[model samples]
Target: MIEFRNVYAGYGGGDVLQGLDLKVEDGSITCIVGPNGAGKSTVLRVLSGLIHPRVGEVRLGGAAIHDKSPAAVLAAGIAQVPQHNALFGNLTVHDNMLLGGYILRRNRRAVRRRVDELAEIFPTVAERAHEKALNLSGGQRRIVEFARALMTGPSVLVLDEPTLGLDPKTCQAVFETTKKINSLGTTILMVEQNVRFGLKLASHGVVMERGRALLAEPADDLLRRPDMGAMFFGHGIEDPTAAPQIATASTDSSGA
Candidate 1:
C-alpha cells in the first residue's frame, strides 16, 4: 500500500501539494482526476522521488520514504512513467527497454530473462525489438514505455497521463494494457485527463482540487455522483462552458 499523510511539496514559487492525506489500497488501480494545476502530476513526482515533500510522511508498504533519492524509491519497488515519452528515439526498442534496467546491468542474465518475460506479456515489444523507438506509432510507443517500466518488476507503478496524445482506439488499447499490468499483481496509480474512461477503468477514483484530495471513493460511486461532475467539469456553476472551477478554491480556466 502507498500512503501520504499531511504531505506538502512544490516547485520554487509555491506549494503545489498542500497537506495531502490519502491512501492507495494494495493491489488496486487508483486513478486521480483533476484540472490542470491541481497538482495531479506533482503527486506522482513526490511518489517517484522527483520531488520531496516539505513536510509529512510518504510510506510504501509501511516503510518511510518521503525524501529518499530516486534510486532509493525504485529500490523500494516503485516505478514511474512520466507524462512525456522517455524513450530514446534513435535506439532500438530492445535497447530502450534495457536502459530501464541499467542498474541491473551487473546481472545481465537476469535482465535478459525479465525482458523475455515482458515480451511475452507485451507482444509489441517482441515485434518491434529490432526497430528504433522513433519508428513506432503512438500506441505502440506507449506499450513499449509500459514494458520498459516493468523491467524492474516493480510492486507499484505510477503512470502520468499514459494516453495523452493517442486516438480513441489506441487510448482504449492503452487502458487495456494498464488493466493487464494491474492484473499481474502490480498496484497502479494513474493521473488522467480522460475523465470518463479513467474513472471507468479505475477501482478507486480520487478527485483533487488545488493540491488537496477533495473526494475519494469507489470509481463507480464517484461516477454516479452529480456533484462530482459539477465539481470537475464546472457544471451548474456561473458559466457551464467555462473550464472546471473547484468550488472550494479560486476560479481558473485550465485544461486537465
Candidate 2:
C-alpha cells in the first residue's frame, strides 16, 4: 500500500496539501476527486517524489519514502503519469518508453527485452514503435504514456486528470484502458476532474476540499450517497444525465 501520513506539501511558500493522511490498497484503483486547486495533482507529485512533503511521512508498504529522489521512487515501484501528456513529442514512441527504464541496467539487451515484453501487453507501442509520439490522438497518447510507465514495472501507477480534453467516446476508451492496466496487477491512484467518470472507474473514492480529505469510500457507494454527490459536483449535484448512455463503462474491475 501507498500512504500519506499527515503529508504537508506545497509550492514556494504556501502548502497546498495540508495534513493529508490517506492510503491506497494494492492492486486496486483509487480515485481522488475534487474541485480546481484542491491539491489533487499535488498528492500524486508527493507520492512520486516530484515534490516532498514539507512535513510528515509518505510511505510505501510502511516504509517512509518522503523526500526520496525520483529515481529512488521509481526503484521503489511507483510511476507517475503527470497532468500533462508528459511524453517527448519530439521523440519516437520506442525511445520515449526506453527512457522509463532509466533506473535499470540500460544495457541494450535488457532494454530490448523489456520493450518487447511491454509491446506484447500494449500493442500500440509495438505497432507504432517508429512513429513520433505527436502523431497519436489524445486517447492514444494517454495509452502510450501508460505503456511508458509500465517499463519501470511499478507496483503503483499514479495518473493525473488522464481523460482531460477528450470527447465522450475517448473518455470511455481511456477508462477501459485503466481497467486493463489494473487487471495486469499494478495498483492505481489517480486524480480525475471527470467526477462521474473517476468514481465509476475506481473501486475506492477519495473526496477532497481545501487540500484536505473529506471522504473515502467504495466508489459505487459514493455514487449512491447524497452527500458524496454534493461534495463532488457542488450543490446542484446532478447525477449523470442519461447514465444509461454512459453505463457501458466497465466497473466490474472495481472490486472494493
Candidate 3:
C-alpha cells in the first residue's frame, strides 16, 4: 500500500499540499478528482520525488520514501507518466522505450527482454517499433508512454491525466489499457479530469479541495452520494469539465 501522512509540500511561493493525507490500497486503482489548483498534480509530484514535502511521511509498503531523490523513488518501485508529452519526438518508439530502462543499461539483455515484453503488451509498441515517436497519433503516443513506464517493471504506476486532450474514443482506449495494467498487478494512482468516467474506472476515489482531501472512499459510494456533484462543482455531474490549473512538476524542477 501507499500512504501519505500529513504531507505539506509546495514550490518556492507557498504551500500547495496542506497536511494532505491519502492512502492507496495494493493492486487497486485510485483516481483523484478535484477543482483546478487543488494540488492534485502536486500530490503526484511529491510522490514522484520531484519535490519533497516539508512535513510528512510518504511510504510504500511501510518503507519511507518522502525524502528519496527521483532516481531513488524510481528504484523503490514507483514510475510516473506525466500529463505533458514526455516522448523524444525524434527517437524511434523502440529507442524511447529503451531509455525508460536507462538505469539498467548495464544489463543489456534484461533491458531488451523488458522491451520485448512491453511490445507484446502494448500493440502500438509492437507495430511501430521502428517508427519515430513524433509520427504516432495522440492515443498511440499515450500507449507507448504506458509501455515505456512499464519497462522498469514498477510495482506502482502513477499517471497524471493519462487521457488528457484525447477524444472520447481514445480516452476509452486509454482507460481500458489502464485497467489491463492494473489487472497485471501494478497498483495505479491516477489524477483524471473526467470525474464520472474516472470514478467508474477506479476502485477507490478521492475528492480534494484547498489542497486537502475532503473525501476518500469507495468509488461507487462517492458516486452514489447525492451531494457529490454539488460539493465538487456546485452543480450536477452531468457535464464534468474542469482542467488542473498548475503545471506538472518535472523530475528536475520544483516549480509545479
Candidate 4:
C-alpha cells in the first residue's frame, strides 16, 4: 500500500499538489481522474521520486520514502510509466526493455528470462522485438512501456495517462493490458484523462480538483451518481432520467 500524509510538492515556484492525502490499497487498482492540470501527474512524480515533496510525507507500505531518488524508489519496488511515451524512438523494442533493468545489471540472466516471459504475454513486443520503437502505434508503445516497467520486477506500478491519443479500439487494447499487469500482483496507481473507461476498471476511484482531492468513492457508486459529471466536468447534470446525453456519457464512461 502507498500512503500520502499532507503531502505537498511542486516545481520551481509553487505547490501543485497542496497538502494531498491519498491511499492506494494493496492488490487493487486505484484511478485518479480530474480536469486538465489538476496536479494529476504531480502525484505520480512525487511518488516516483521525480519531484520532491516540500512538506509532509509519503510511505510505501510502512516505510517513509519521501524525497528518495528515482533509482532508490524503483529499488523499493515501484515502476512508473510517464504521461507521454517516454521511449527512445531509435532503439529497438528489445533494447528499450533492457534499459529498464539497469538496477538489475547483476542479474543479467534473470533479466533476460523476465524479458522473454513478458514478451510472451505481450505479443506486440515479441513480434517487433527487433524493430525501432518509433514504428509501433501509440497503443502498442504503451504496452511495451508496461513490459519494460516489469523488467525491474517492481510490486507497485505508477501510470500517468496510459491512454490519451489512441483511437477507441487502441484504448481498449491498452485497458486490457493494464488489467493483465494488475492481475500479476503489481498494485496499480494511475492518472487518467478519460474518466469512465479507467474508473470502470478501478477498484478505488479518486476525484481531484485544483490540486486537492474533492472526493473518494467506490467506482460503481460514483458512476451511478449523475452529480459526478456536473461536479467534475462543470455540467449541470443532476438526474439521469432528465438528461439522456449525460446518462449516455456517464454510462459509456463507466465501461458498461
Residue 213: error of model 2 in Å? 1.0
Model 1 clash pairs?
none
Find the 10 residues in a row with the least total lDDT in model 2.
Answer: 247-256
Q: Provide the TM-score for each candidate, comma-separated.
A: 0.90, 0.87, 0.89, 0.88
Q: What local lDDT score does residue 112 receive in model 2, on the 0 to 100 scale?
A: 75
By the lDDT metric, which is better: model 1 or model 4? Answer: 1
lDDT of 3 by residue, 73-107 (tens): 99999999998688999999999998998864538
Clashes of 1: 0
Tens digit of lDDT per residue, candidate 2, span 1-256?
8778777899997899878778788899999988777788888888878898988888899898997988898888998888666899989999998887764656777777888998998788899998999998887788889888888788999888898888898888788889999999999999998888999999988777777766667888767765555655454234555233223222321111
Lowest lDDT block of 10, candidate 3: 245-254
Which pairs, if any, clash in model 4?
196-253
Candidate 1 residue lDDT tens string, 38-137: 8899999899998999988799989999989999899889998877667999999999988888764537778888889999999999999999999999
Sorting all predicted structures by lDDT, with the top scorer first, yields: 3, 1, 4, 2
Model 2 stretches with alpha carbons more than 4 Å out: 233-256
RMSD of 1: 5.5
